[model samples]
Target: MSDATAPQPFNKEIPTDEEGKFRGYAKARADFLHVRLVVAACGALIIYIPHSWHFALITVIAVCLAEALDTISLNQSIKRLNSGAPLRPELRFSLYTAAFQALLFSGVVIGGAILQPRVTIDMFLICYLFAAVMNAGMLLYFNSAATYLRLLIYGITMILIISMRWMYFAGAPVLAYETAATLLLAYIAFRVIDFVENNFREQEQDKVNALSRQKSMKTQLEVYANKERHLLQLAAVAKHANDSVIVFDKTGRITWVNDAFTEITEYPRDEAIGRRAGTILNGPMTSPETVAKIEHAAATHSPLRIEIQYYTKSGDPIWVETNLVPLPSSPEMDGGMIAIERNITNSKLRQSELANAMRNAERSERAKSEFLATTSHEIRTPMNSIVGLTDLLSEHDLDPAAREYVVALQDSAQSLVRIVNDILDLSKLEAGKLKITPSVFEPGHFFNKLDNLMRPRAEAKGLSLSIDLPDDLPLLYADEGRIRQILVNLIDNAIKFTRSGGVTVAVQGARIANTCRFSVDVTDSGIGISESGMRRLFGYYAQAEDTTSQKYGGTGLGLAISRHLAREMGGDLTAVSHEGQGSCFSLFLPIACTDQSLEGIEEVTQIPEAPTANLAERTILVAEDNATNRMLMSKFLEKCGAEIVFAEDGQQAVDLFCAKQPDLILMDMQMPIFDGVEATSRIRALDAPQPYIVALTANAQKDDRDRCLKSGMDDFLTKPVRKVELLDTIYKVLADRPMMEKPLS
Candidate 1:
């Protein structure tokens, strides 16, 4: 292996044992001093030995040599440790000291045995054991080898003392026995000393740990004190803040108010205290709901923010956005509420201005709709008269040129009506008032109707029309009229644009979740659209080109209207085209399939038209405010075999209806005094039998129709109604319901 890849040496190990006890230079030096101290103290006991002076001098010399040797060894080890060098001290120093000390202890006992044997042996045992217990265990207990060697030397010296007393010194057997018993006592004392040293070490560790915990607790207390001081500072800031701050007591009574409160409310803090917040601040502009919300938030221990109106001491109203903060109950402080209120009078004024502007915009929109409806009515009323008169003139014999002129007039009038209808329809769509009413119908019949309607136009343009429907297609659930209208617009556009070739409409279906998605692709071989022309093709009032618009003479709204209608039915309309190949438009609709067994699908059965009733027997009331409209209606009904009675206003209509008691009443809305709704309501509330009431109004909005129906009118019809529709509604209402089971609507 290369040197770069070789393993590195580890860092030096700590000078500590498994019990985490430190045996470094400082501890070793302390041990050295302690050993010397024990030696000097033992020398003082030499007076008790036989030949006290000699024994004392010899013990001092031995102690001095032992202390010098221990000091030299400890100093050498400390130098090695300080210089960061590995220590290799000789163990002979410890071995020699233990042996020399043991021998000195033996000599003292032996000298006593050789002279006054009984007394000195016992005194010597007492002094030696005491010195061993105090210093021997502590000095070298961490060094196992030295500790064991010292213990061995003590045991051997005890055996030697026994021999010297009894076997060799002509001493009593009791002295030998006393020496042996003293050895046993010394062993037991060492055992006790060992236990005491361990206890001391444990006490030292516990003291360190206790000091660490105390320091940590002191730091935490200091941090808590700092935080408490910060809170006091914050309270001082709040007391002098510029925003009004009111403190409510447990009973919802104001207990305190900041300087800002006095400045804003024009009331001194002392006077504001002890008063209810609502009683002090609430005025004509204050809302009960906002007050209730504050009380509710306090009771529930939640916070509430509201824009509140308050009157000052000068009785001038001001708006404020107030936050009610609920305080939690605790032993140190009673529970209450703190309301921090910021003035928002200018903001409230700006909001009022915005609200007024929105109201004006709404009024403008309503006025626009009214104007459109009224204008449409005025135009259509005369247009209806012209169309009806033209129809009557067509039946008379005339020259070919005059008849052609009349036909042209009829077509032009019809075109104008269609334009008006489109404008109204677009308006309704933009206003989101056009609602889709869904019903179940057979797909085969639905497509068949479109096929029949487009076939003649397609053939007239020298193009073939064909439809391809899947055999397994089920009955569909959607707005039948809307789907039919969208398809008609698509198919008519296809026929109108294509002059040659053919148009093919293919119906394909696939199951999409619970519903089936049907795509009707209408491909036409016509003048294909360019890329730029296709970009805005489906936009409102957009056509393929200026030339196309000039030549075709159309509103260019068909595709745009068709696409929106398709989306409102939960689908979309898409188109794909090539420059020369032709254009294909696809209408996709996702409609649910109906269960055939349930027979819930509505059948397209035609209602038979009711026959005109006898005019001699029937009496009708025509309540129209417009003179021309009233005259036009009277003539139309007079021809339909009914006696017509006219009312100029709603009040007049009500009076005529009650006086004549007509079989039916045709009422117009937006009249003087009472409107159609009030008139109808009054007629229905009469004690007599209620006659059939039908609304004939220039107000063409759905809201108008809904109001008419809600006011007890049986039927509603927009103004400028066709002669056939008017006659039909009249015949149907007057016809006997019991004879027909249900009158045709």
Candidate 2:
């Protein structure tokens, strides 16, 4: 639909040929009708005669009727043309109607001239006819046939009026001049019409060309509109995205950037655009290699993703992960690039901090390990002397008070060693380095031995200790040492807290398939722990109460180490108790059962009171750095019936072995003039009888033991080396080797 007020611009949608011609005719007729009655009245008045009002009135009526008829014809023609009717018939009708209107107007002029034949009036009438022809030609020129037909009617009427006047009033000479002038005027009118017709044809051709151009422009506009819509959508996404988006030319000059880009760089859009990204974002700390990688990717028209350090507008350094992609070539921009970048400053900082923390943790662990090793060696050197001398003292016929003191000294020394051992065990467990070596052993015998060991402590506290073991025990495949350690810790805690009530060790076993589940309950009528205390009971160095350590004298590490050991052996330790009643600590273990019997074993329900330390006719060499330990070892070996040769350091010990070829060597690992490991290596390298070498050191870490064995030592022991342990090692070695009866020198 077209706007009624605004003229419609020419386009293909409008039928430019027939429709335009029809509209032109309609419009011209409307314009002629607006003034037709006025023109008729003025002409009648201009040629007024007495009682000639009716003539004027008739002319007006006739003009009105002609206008109404022309309008009806025009409307019908327009409808037919809109219905796709042929243009030639409508144009011919238009020519006929226009000629009729021209004839009516020419009759008015010729009638006025005949009624009032003054030469001036006649000349005025001739001029009016000429004007009317010119007006008709101007209006109807869109249809050349209509314009020419109207022009011919008015031309013939003017020439007929001129000839009639000349024949009535003037001579033949005057007639010739008038006729010639009228023909000249006709010629001019025809020339004007021809000019207008030619111009209309040119204008119509221009309108067709304009219509074609307008169609092409409309297609281009639609394409541009679609492209603009896509661009707007892309802009909206980039504007709100979290990552920075940037577009730059092949020369690395930024052409566009999104809001995120400006926010990340702390640069405004106007300042950021038209500048090289590297110039603004890259800083002194930025890696040269990373920059080179980006440059190479860009130069090769390839995509790349990299993390690089960049500086903001304020010169603060940050890290970003950038994805650089090449843009497809376009006419407006031949080769360009777009970069999507994410800020990773916080992540990078966290990585750096984590790395630093890991390095620090490793260093701390190493330091802790070294400190423990050194402290163990330093403390145990004197502890060995204390325990050994106490054992030697007990052998004498001493008074009861002296014996009590010696026993106390021995207990204190043992307690110190337990604390050191607990600390080391906890460290190993926490460091994930504790080794659990499984072995086949009789569960009955194992519990019986633990019962024997803990009974003495129970009796000393005036508390009776009892062990209830299942009669049908399986040969359990498990880490016996670790299990015994946990039980010992549990029983020790039980007896330690109990004053009057006794402690009981109850063992229940269930066998299914090849696995045996054991529940060893160490219950005691002792001071029970509160719920809060139970919560932290298995934490490192945590006890039942704050004053528990002060009152009971413990390192508070036993239960923690015990629980760790139990779990390491595929088991768990739990406890249930009520305050003021008692606590029952249960040890659960899933040990694989074996059908095979214990090899080379005796079914001793109770451990022997003592190990037979008979080393008669044996020559032993002791290498020690500490003088007290050396004296202690000498007294212990001599008391065990073995002849002792002493050395102050590793070098002297090796010399003594070369000379005497002692049957056994007690090598103090951390000694002067190279440690026991080097001394043992040197002694083992000798082309002589190899002495049984036992490593004695307080560095109780498993690595120390492995290292000692690796250095050719026959056995490894952690101090404080009990006199019994030293003598047992010597006796076992002699028994195994069947030493020759070398005299006591």
Candidate 3:
């Protein structure tokens, strides 16, 4: 918490008057010396006045007694001032000293009157008045205020003395002396009055200046009070806030802490206060770099924002964001820092989760791309042999049993193509690159399509497949392609996993909401997922069981893609299953409301079938780098009754084509001398009849195909060639050639 008290002023030296007790003693001794000198001067003046020896002696004794008493009072006053007590003792002593001196003077006057009976009383009276005036002046010198009061008191004494003098000397020669003495005394009184008046005026002006300064200070203090109140309110709010707040001095001491700080650090304010901030809060896990940064900020008076790991009171490490600021007003004062710490442990954990998600996404993408490339190569390799051999077999008269076996082979090949295309579609959907094309269609038609697609697979698995569509179901305005993809993936997963149970897809609800939800539940009696497996069931490439790779074969991306698509369509896909029990997968889709009549949904056309015929009369050239692939192509093509010529690389193929004039060339990419792309370019540049060129390369990436096309190849073919794709491509290229230059003739 922020400190509430204002800093004390910096004092360098002590005042001389308040230095020590000994100074007070020195002051008292100085006053005593002055009083003694005054006494001696009075004695000398009395001796010159021609008084009797006894009178003079008595006068000396009186003066001596007065001085002694005054000295004692002064000493007492100094002692009281030094002791730091009230001025009562000093004032009382001063008053007593004044009284004593007054009595002494009165005695002198009375004694003179009694001893000098021959001497007119007027002379004695004049001498007494003079002594009174002198005493009053001495009183004024001793203490200013006391002196003024004494002067007034003694002025009345002088008046009484004058009255006595006038009565006694009215018929005596001493009247002249009395008159002179009275004039001088009156003048002295006048002077004392003038001096006192001036002194009083000076003191009054000093009082006015003092009051002015005090009033200005009061105004400033009022402003300060308002500001302090505001700051106090702010401090209270900061102290009560949920975030832990701590203030540290420039020396790194924990000067203040809020309630929240105590709650977080588990250290009470009393225990934390005056302790070093680092010693209490820092632990082994705390970074040295963070500590260095805090020190740098304090030393340089810079504000800093940093995130650090700090141990809580329970010794648990928690992440905190600390905002440190410097107080710049007082460099000499301690506690110049404001530290506010907020718990960010949850946020850090969330950030970690997101980072892991991104990494997983990247890995999934790489896997999909790899799968596509590998599958392309795998499907096409055998396809070339099948299609080529089938063409060769078509040329011969074959038994009916042989024909049936060939047909089966063709069916299996087509199935593989369909599976590859499905995988590709799922990959596109997962990548968010699949486009949606919405159309008005009957919900029944959608179900029928699903029935047709999955009925065969279900029959193969010896499982029943059913669909439930309410007659009242309205037309759904949704992307037919996406909806079909979702159904296909879910039903396929059900069929693949279920050994005996049937798969059911049900559709319901077409009300005022202008939408319909189709629930596709595929229940299987096969092995169900475990609780731990369910956690990652919807994750990409995560199978339902640990041995899924051995027991069931799948890309594991089906459910993941289905869920993503379902969500994109403003619906969701969920699953419920238990170990050893059947699993139910449901897909919910929002119905589309439209006034138009539902029409039959169109399906994409299947690949055209190739005519079975032998190309033995035609001559073909094989250009390949890999020896195994080259031999495979040679054997397969020769079995079709075609005369075959081989080239180890692209450059050889180009040279052989110019000499042999073969009907076609199967080019391989990644060769030792020259690759397929270069060979194709060189072949097209030749003056001779350009052989029907087809790229048969392992570089199956999309960019690779574009490059092959740009090189003037008639067609692009990925490696591990399929029999059907190779033959179909050959026929297409040959069909487009000019008949006048037909090499087979």
Which scores higher on lDDT, 1 or 3? 1
Residue ranges of candidate 3 with Cα displaced over 4 Å: 1-457, 465-489, 504-525, 530-532, 565-571, 578-581, 588-648, 652-672, 680-701, 704-745
TM-score of each: 0.60, 0.63, 0.38
Clashing pairs in 2: none
TM-score-best of 2 and 3: 2
Candidate 2, run of 10 with poorest lDDT: 1-10
Q: After superposition, how far is residue 622 of candidate 2 from its true place, in Å?
A: 1.9
- Model 1: runs farther than 4 Å from truth? 1-212, 215-222, 225-345, 383-418, 452-464, 496-503, 525-530, 537-561, 578-582, 596-675, 696-698, 718-736, 739-745
Cα deviation of 58 in candidate 1 (Å)? 34
Ranking by TM-score: 2, 1, 3
Q: List, residue by residue over 128-233, the lDDT tens digit for candidate 1.
A: 5445534555534345455566556655656665665566447555665676677677777678657755665565566667767888899899999999999998
Q: Which sections of candidate 2 miss by over 4 Å? A: 1-234, 270-275, 313-315, 328-335, 399-401, 530-532, 600-619, 639-643, 653-663, 678-691, 734-745
Overall local distance difference test of candidate 1? 0.71
lDDT of each model, Cα atoms only? 0.71, 0.78, 0.67
Model 3: residue 336 alpha-carbon error in angstroms: 30
